[model samples]
Target chain A: MVFDKKKSPYLFLLPFLIMFFSFWLWPILQSLYWSMLEWDGLRAPTFVGFRNYIKLFSEQDYIIALSNTVSAAIVYIGIMVIVALFLGFMLNSSILPGRAAFRTIIFLPVTVSLPVIALVFFIIFAKNNGVLNNIISTLGFGRSIDWLGDPRINLWSIVSLRIWRASGFYAIFILAGLQSIPEEVIEASIIDGASGWKTIRLIVLPLLRPVIIYVIIASSIWAFQLFEEPWILTRGGPVNSTATIAMHVYRNGFQFFQLGYASASAYVLTAIIVVFALIQLLINKGK
Target chain B: MKKVLTAAAILLLSFGFLSASGAEESKAEGPIELSYWGWGPHVVGVNETISPAFKEMYPDVTVKAEALGPWDLMDKFYVSMVSGKGAPDAAQLVRRVSEKYLISELLYDFTGFMNEYDGQFSEALNRDVLSVDGKYLGIPLDYGPSALFYNKPLAEKLGIDVSTIVTWDDFYELAVKISREYPDLYIMTQYYPAGTWGSNYYRMFMQSAGANIYDAEGKVIRNNQKMVEVLEFLYKLHADVKTLNIPVNDPLMWEESRKNNILFYPRNSYFSGEMEQQVPEMDGVIHTIPWPLWSEDDDPQYTGNWGGVALVVPQKGPHADIAAEFCKFFATNVEALTQHWYTTTGVPSYAPARDNIIKDNTNETFAKGLMEAITVREVGPWYYTDWAQTEKILGDGLDNMFGGKLTPAEAWQWTEDQLIKILGR
Candidate 1:
């Protein structure tokens, strides 16, 4: 059914278009404008013209947090997507029993609220009598490690926790993707005497490329703004090792009341994320 | 979209009505609404408990008491006062707020309130509040004379005598002994922030040694050889004792850290409630002893914080008389405040409140804690007492020494560099 040339193309979309403009579209434009100004969220904004961006260099914490965020995005997405794919394959396989029970267990973290996960994990990672320390001490180490205290191990600690908490959600996405793969294709590949390993590598992996690409792009975008986990877990301590760009933006905006500076950081973050996504897309296109 | 506009209109109308009600209900002529800010689950609980009574007595007058939590509440209040809106009628100020918050004109000078209530308040409260700028800022709500909290079970387990642990050397020896034996849990600890270096080690210990970090006026008189000795000694403790917390991976770590991991911390009565919140299992094991026997004759006894929350009537607020009345009533009411303290589950600032709570108190859990409150000491803050130097110069200097950024002698030089920035004289 082709639209009549006389009919208004936007007539059907007017309500949603208004909503999109008001809620999503306008805020983005406003944020972009505010990013250049030195506004404290209360007073009239002063146009600083990239001074906030320049100060980002002197801020040791912001620089460290930026690196931490980049690393988290790469590591979290890499492991989570791969593990999710593998879990999807295993869950759907005939070799696995009680798929319902297995799926429920694996998907538990996805259903759990992020704050709840943070609280539970914080309890588990407590430096002294926490479950982890109990296990470690039982191994004859005879000491509790400063899991959140020592600057060296703090960021890695957040990374491991993020992976544990996020992988299950990714698992569901990949599982749906796996289930969507045609049974007839696998049957034909099997009839052609493609080994199981060879089939997964050559046929299934390449075939699942679109779904995998979707998963990576979507998950990486979310991962780039990782905040709550690091914020709650370490509060950007034992000395700013786990501070992320989003966390810095949040603190400066809310706690420090430096709204303009926070906006600048956010805009820069958006730029970084866009560039990363573009480069990944370009590489995938070349591949 | 038009529906949304109508809804926005309705919301704006409702907000307008709210502001109108706020203005209308506010004191027009008699007994105005006094908005006060303070902390202590007790103060919060006390305000709630007393509200019925307060409102009952002053039917026309209303007092809104806002209670903020421990860590960032002060900072939030400072940001508000600086930004110029939504401030309470009166605010709870720390003794060091003069420097921490350098607003000269905004804060109400409570010299009049102090003079009027001089007869009503306790001598200790008056001394602490009156000492700052020799002018009072606010009325007293609660006090926080910190003591050395100990684990009785852990102490018994180690066969330690609390009596002998008075001097820095004596405390150090016991820590070494505890470390050698336990090896896993920390023997003694405090949070390693750059700010508390002078308070915990220098001022507190110096006060014990009978010295003050500064003179009556802000001066760097604390740069003595003994100060160097304490800083060096504490930096070495960072190496000797494992800090109460380990890495962030272990789940039970904070509980154990709050409970069995650390033997002692230089904290106030607030720690009692916090410890209970964090580790109820160690309730019986925890005990508070007076800040371990400081010798304060020779040194300016570093009794920095007597922990009082002041109630003030803002010069601009609608209800100055009502706010003052509430302040007077709340301060004098020992029974109501005792309940507030118990329910807030903290050490009461007033001596009578502590005595009332401890008298025939059947809950054996916090009984010994009640005793710690019973032995009230007045080691409060020195106002205009900018801790910036002690905090920046002395505290961060300790961290720097620990990080191997500066040696003990070089730390002295480095501290001198920071002294100028923090003190600016």
Candidate 2:
């Protein structure tokens, strides 16, 4: 008679629901209202309904940030998926010894600090004297390439580092998925005269669908919040080439102290993220 | 079920009560546990800047300063200010949106407090804080008086008469020669995508032409000939004379330039610490000159007048009058001023403080020159500075021009287009 736990799990969820509503839901609702305003954080956010969003359409910097974010996302997700699958295959390979060590090495970047990773990459790709550039120069190359200078290529420099950082983490997830695959099914595939590639393509790849979706969802969410690297490395510049929306939002809020404008931008960015999540959910559902 | 609900309600209410009680306790008199948040070499770890002196003076008002990474600090400040949580009373707000706060009714006005304590500090009070409407929201923290830091060794090595480098063209020639001579050595570190543009160039050129982003009224003025000249001049050095690949994000760029094969770096006031560190073996290897004179003025002078940090009393605090008095005390006290200057490697706002700081200053040869540079600096402190926007014009513009993406005029036009978009005028 007393609140039936089985009949109403919503009752059990009520506390979490309240906490979520108070913090996340309320801020998100507030931000949507702000997106329509003209604010500079410190001052009263004037209600310039839809002007901020209107401006966002034509703004070159925002466009650049948006594109760069897409580029980072593609590179980040692509690396995660590709590396995760490859490492999974390696982990599944019985002939390849030291699976545990390989898994540990691939998974280590996730545990390490990103700034430290960035610092290491910063030294490696430095124009005047990066380890990688030094090696390139030593190989009888004429010029020391400015890795993060060229506007078109600077985004790649960031993406490569991002790939290096994220692939290992995704590999762990893929490895877990590979482990979940029952031995009997794989043995049956092997006896059916399927080669390693065929077995992977038909048996392992098809079965790891849920894990793949999880990896995509998790990484996409992480990719949306690509602030620390862009903040640390180029700061969305050589001229707004690397400027992500998150970094821009951060700048408006903090550096510029145009909180109202920043909040509006934040909400716009949040909406964009929500759209991305929704699209991801739709895709997962279709799958 | 009833018992469980009662327990849950009690816990929630008690936690809320505890939080409110903590806020009350923070405001209480007995050993005031106040926390000041800022960004620098972690304030708590490195107890040099905000010292034990303040703690000693007000033993009851215990202050623990913490450093949040500068950008992160700004983000937290923004969030806290809006949400009304975890904001420090006297947090250092950057001077970017000091305008919006002035025009709009946001910050706690500090005019009444300033008038009351006119005796303690001198006339070095930065009037730049007050908007056109005359509401002083922010106290000047640090001034960026642009100066030309020339490596004496590098200049001597290049065999260029450093004194003859009077104009932007002349500096360019000297820089090119030094760069050509020492192929490995860049003439200077001209960073893009950061404090690269709209700074030394912007101030110097703007002052040179007597035109700025605003003209008395806080209106956006984009098309200034001088502003264009600033971009064009930077484009020349950036295109023809190759500078180092340095992104001016960290303060350490100055240090890197000095250590590497660089001749002159045009920055403001803070390069003294860098020079001191770079050429520690050679006691007097560096000299500070006025920013390389850019324009053809009747009586040419360099501009570096980025007014340094100022003290302010927050709106609501216990003993607000006493807090104002503390600011005045610290601002005036020669000993305190000297400590601030020495510890922060920041310039003293007070002219009197200059004498004490320079007397026993164990910095590089630039110490004497720096004080003189500050004295002679033509400050053009503007309120509404879109630093990111202008840097796009100068930094990214220069880079593209170098890579042959756009011609100088085309780059300028593109920049103008971008600025129009940013400033919306």
Candidate 3:
């Protein structure tokens, strides 16, 4: 081999490029190829053109999965952002004693394993002898509501868990944003006879937009890919009310063994994620 | 530094080339090593006993057994099978999830091997599960025939002769009587809307009623009159009578329910061992019985099956012969079956082995009851193929009915439409 010292830097990049192509780039390309086939994962992948995509679009379960995911992302993102901001502000506020302790308490959920947390919540939300249901029954409700069993309430149950688990992590970022705000700016607002709420509305809120946007984007992405919590808690049941699109992907790929169809669903999910992310970016740009 | 770097580059290139060529060396075998994949702790323990026994029969063929959870096994199978790499020579596939892979035709047909056994295997599995168009796809390892496990103490306390409750209606009457006496107690903790309830018990009830959610051809038959009648019957029993209690899936809660509250649980015989393991307090109190019928007149004497695993050889693997022999040995040989049974808590799929077991151990009423129910009826061919999908649809309907979102009639409609949409009817 001809050696050139100047080109050796490019040689240094070769290993990384090879790994990237082998692992990441190759799989994406392979996925695209598999998406157009009729494969059950074991047999030779038969070319089906666009039929898998067409079939996916027509499936009610897919629609349910998508709608459930989208609704969850919207609701969870909205609530998470607000709660995160409040906690962030509280943790960042100089007047609040034991702010570190409060931050630690809030962050505890984010640090705990998702499946473990889900198991704990599954117990707390069981129809009979559950912590919450027992409390409800003791408070004069004749019968305990099946928190995880009732379709109407189950999605909200998952949403509550998502919010509880996510708020702390989001708040940490928001807290960073809170800290970054110039102390002089708040002092000036207070000197101008602005009330605490008014100052927060005018100053903190405006300055925290970028971090809030980041939080929203990250949280929405997490919400869209919600799997373990609902999977462990309900297995996407009480009907398909809690079945997220990712769960559908998993069910198709693993359970049903429809790899081609699953790949199509996956690409569509990727497109959805891209579109949502782009929308967030466009909104941020517009602002 | 440059000399060292140049040497390193050459060494790396040589290593890659060596590895690429080293793949061919796998063919250079003195002893055939067959890789057998299975799941759960039982897989390892069972294989530990079976491997040596298998080697004793065929000393030249070495067995390499591995275990993973059911889902993980599927995952590994997918990764290996799809890429045409790392495929196990044989695997213990969960029968419920095995049908989808049959379409791939990747499994080595065991019809010849099964014929070699010639009536040694369980008759019901030979007819229903393993056979596809006169070809056997795999050899059955074991089966989980559904049976009713009741708390004898609870039944005695209530003066309920559970054995006399031949029909489901009679069982419901027993439930009502018990509930009248003890308002807090329920017949069982049914996992509703979803869970094993839809997968196991509902299917058992439907089969006992001479109707299944899907026909043999994988067509939706949920709207069949028998199916509708059964749904209505269960609806009334669950909704009106309110016999089910504690709709939860937690092990702790399950332990509590089995120990204290629930009276009658219709589960598979596979759970008989686990019952004692899970709640040791209920060890002597629990007894197994044949699943109650919808009516005395219900014919074909059919029943439902729960979880089971089967051994299959992958066609793409190098050692099909050794894998097939291993599968045959495990499926047919009395020694291997007995070892598998004792080690893994598995009931042998081989009739002779099963007979030997039942004959030798007459005291385990659960196993004896399971043996009697085993040859009766297995799941329809389409059951495992579309299991997850069917479960979701039927599960939703069940949820709707029990959650008070829809009446049984409306839930039936929902299930039918959903199945139609999903199954492309």
TM-score of each: 0.74, 0.84, 0.88
Please write out the lDDT profile of model 1 over residues B172-266, one tens digit for every residue: 77787778878676775544342222234334444433334555566665456655765666676777765553222223344555556667765
What would the TM-score be for candidate 2 when compared with the true structure? 0.84
Per-residue C-alpha lDDT of model 2 across residues B253-352, encoded as one tens digit per residue = 5435546556677766655654454445544666776665666573535464433444444455444444444455555556766665544456655556
**Which segments of candidate 1 are over 4 A away from where they belong?**
A1-47, A110-146, A281-287, B1-40, B60-115, B118-140, B189-230, B246-254, B257-262, B278-284, B293-300, B304-333, B345-425
Cα deviation of A281, candidate 3, in Å: 2.6
Better of 1 and 2 by TM-score: 2
* Candidate 2, residue B42: lDDT: 27
Off by over 4 Å in 3: A1-6, A94-98, A182-185, A191-193, B1-25, B31-34, B58-64, B103-105, B193-197, B213-223, B241-249, B298-300, B342-345, B362-388, B400-425
Candidate 2 chain B weakest ten by summed lDDT: B193-202
DockQ for each of the predicted structures, in order? 0.15, 0.37, 0.36
On TM-score, the leading prediction is 3
| Chain B alone, TM-score, model 3 | 0.84
TM-score, chain A only, candidate 3, equals: 0.93
Angstrom error of the Cα, residue B173, model 2: value is 2.0
